[model samples]
Structures are given as structure tokens and as C-alpha cells.
Target: MAHTITGRKRLLARVRRIQGQASALEKALTDGTECAALLQQIAAIRGATNGLMAEVLDGHLREHVGAEGLSAGERERELDQIAAVLRSYLK
Candidate 1:
């Protein structure tokens, strides 16, 4: 199993919610729903997805990057990789 299997499951759940959100948006559009409301829904889904990604990343950091048994240099390298990921995510 992957290191973050639990986290991946949680992320998948969030994504499923987003899928529902998208379906609702689609239905609303088909029914001629207001553009503003659709946009709001899109923004909400985006926020939720970003939050999910953050959770997954945090789990990964705690597991591999910050594993308690790692050597000092290995930990430093992993942390550096994590920092890069954080920077990319921020962008």
C-alpha cells in the first residue's frame, strides 16, 4: 500500500464531493441557473479540492518526510523536497 493510503481515501472522498458539486452545477446550468451561483459553486469546489490536497500533502510529510526513524541528513533532504512541494502548491 502507498504511504498515504488513508489520506488518499480521504482525498478521494473529498473529490467525490466535488464530483457531486460539479453534477449539481451541471444540473443547475441545464435548468438555466444564474451564472453567479454557478461561479460560486465552482469556487467552492476549487477551495475544497485545494484543502484536500493540503491534507494529503500533510499526511505525506508526516509519514515519509518527517518519519521519526530517519537519519538527520535524510530528514533534511526530505524536508527540502517537502518545502519545494509547498512552494509549488502555493503557486
Candidate 2:
């Protein structure tokens, strides 16, 4: 919660940038932009979204999981599960 509060502005900025990207994507589609350009916009949005996910995941790991006194093996297993979920989600 403290991390979220402190990072609120930065996170909101990222979200607003993503929203702008979405708007641009919509405009491009409406204006019949070229396929290559449209694909590039989509890739940009995906990259930004992935970045945001990584930021949140990092904070979660540090503040929640990392603070816990889990054994090395347990931590590794937990992280592996998280990675699996992230992979499935991205797919």
C-alpha cells in the first residue's frame, strides 16, 4: 500500500500514456492506416503493457513475497508459478 501510494503518480502516468496509445490505435484503424504502421502501434502498446505488468510484479515480489521468511526452494517454486502464469497470460 505504501509503495502504491508513493508510486501513484508514476503508475498513473504510465496508464495515461497507454491510454494515449490506445487512442492512437483507434484513430489509425479508423483512418485506414497501413498494416505495418498499425502493427507497430500494437507492438508498442503490448510492450508498454508488459512493462507495467513487470513493475507491479516486481513490487509485489519485493513487498509481499520477499519480506516473508520463505526458504530458497519455496521462493523459487513460487516465482516459477508466477512466471508460468505470466507466460500463459501473455499467450
Candidate 3:
């Protein structure tokens, strides 16, 4: 998780933005926001989440799957891990 630790501040900033967006969504709902506006908020949240996932997933792949000098077996295991995570995320 070294890559993540190095980028923790940036990632946390993204997470906080998502949190703020969700909070605004809730507030909008309570204030009777239009359907279009609500849908836009949801889309924004999804986009932000996807960006975060992409960033972390890239780091994970670099660290585990594509690290130099890794044995074939280790790379395979990392591939399996990524597959499982992708499966769960897709669901």
C-alpha cells in the first residue's frame, strides 16, 4: 500500500469531494430538487468513484502484478486478486 500511502492526501481529497456531493444530494432531495438535477448529482458521484477506483487499481497493478522481478506465480495471484475485486465491483 505504499503507493496509496504516498497519494493518501490526494485520494482523501477526492473522497471528501464525493462525501460533499452525496451530502448535497441529500440536501437537494430534502429540498425537492428536480429529477434532472438529482440524476446529475448521482452521475457526478459515480464519475468521482470511478476515478478513485482507477487510481487505486492502477497502483495495485503496478505494485503487485507488474512489479519487477516478481515470480510468475506472484503475478498470477495478483491477477486473480484484481479479477475478484473487479467482479465484486461489477456486481
Candidate 4:
């Protein structure tokens, strides 16, 4: 969102790090890394991804759903959108 533009750099940095982590995981699989190390890598990736999702979702809740100037209709729309996204993401 435009409100998140201020934090875009930080978000992008997190995404880049996650990309690098995924690449490392790929390389590790190619090299047949140990199971423990592989599990650690996978966990790290999942945690980082969840962190990114939480950050964006928090921003959306604040700027789009919970903002003082937003009408009930607008808030409902934003809530529905986020709920749909949460359902999909959970699956």
C-alpha cells in the first residue's frame, strides 16, 4: 500500500534476505546437506516469511482497516479482503 511506501525499503530488504535463504536451501539440497541443517534452513525461511506477512498485514490493518477517517463500508471491505487473504494463506 502507499502508506507502506515509507517502509518499502525495509520490506524489500527482508524479501531479498529470504530470497537468499531460499537459494541457499536449494544449494544445500543439491549438495545433499544433513537433515538437521536442512530443517534449520526450512524453519528459517518459514519464520522470515511469516515475519514479512505480519508486517504487511499490520500496516494494512492500521492504514486501511483501522484508520479514523475510514467509513464503515470501507472498513468492512478492507476487513473482508484481509480475511480472504488470511484464509488463503492459512491453507
Candidate 3: regions farther than 4 A off: none
TM-score of 3: 0.95
Residue-level lDDT tens digits of model 4 in 1-91 = 7757989999999999999999999999999999999999999999999999999999988887988998889888989999999999999
The candidate maximizing lDDT is 3
RMSD each, Å: 2.6, 2.7, 0.8, 0.9
lDDT of 3 by residue, 1-91 (tens): 8989999999999999999999999999999999999999999999999999999999988887889999999888989989999999989
lDDT of 4: 0.94
> How does each model score on lDDT?
0.83, 0.87, 0.95, 0.94
**In candidate 1, what are the lDDT values of residues 1-91, reduced to their tens digit?**
2556756677778889989998998998999999899999889888987888777777787788767899999998988988897898789
| Candidate 2 Cα outliers beyond 4 Å, as residue runs | 69-88
lDDT of 2 by residue, 1-91 (tens): 5667778899899989999999999999999999999999999999998888888778767875686788888888878977897889779
Location of the lowest summed lDDT over 10 successive residues in candidate 2: 59-68
> Which segments of candidate 1 are over 4 A away from where they belong?
1-3, 26-32
Better of 3 and 4 by lDDT: 3
Q: Assess candidate 3 and give its lDDT.
A: 0.95
Of models 2 and 4, which has the larger TM-score? 4
Clashes, model 2: 0
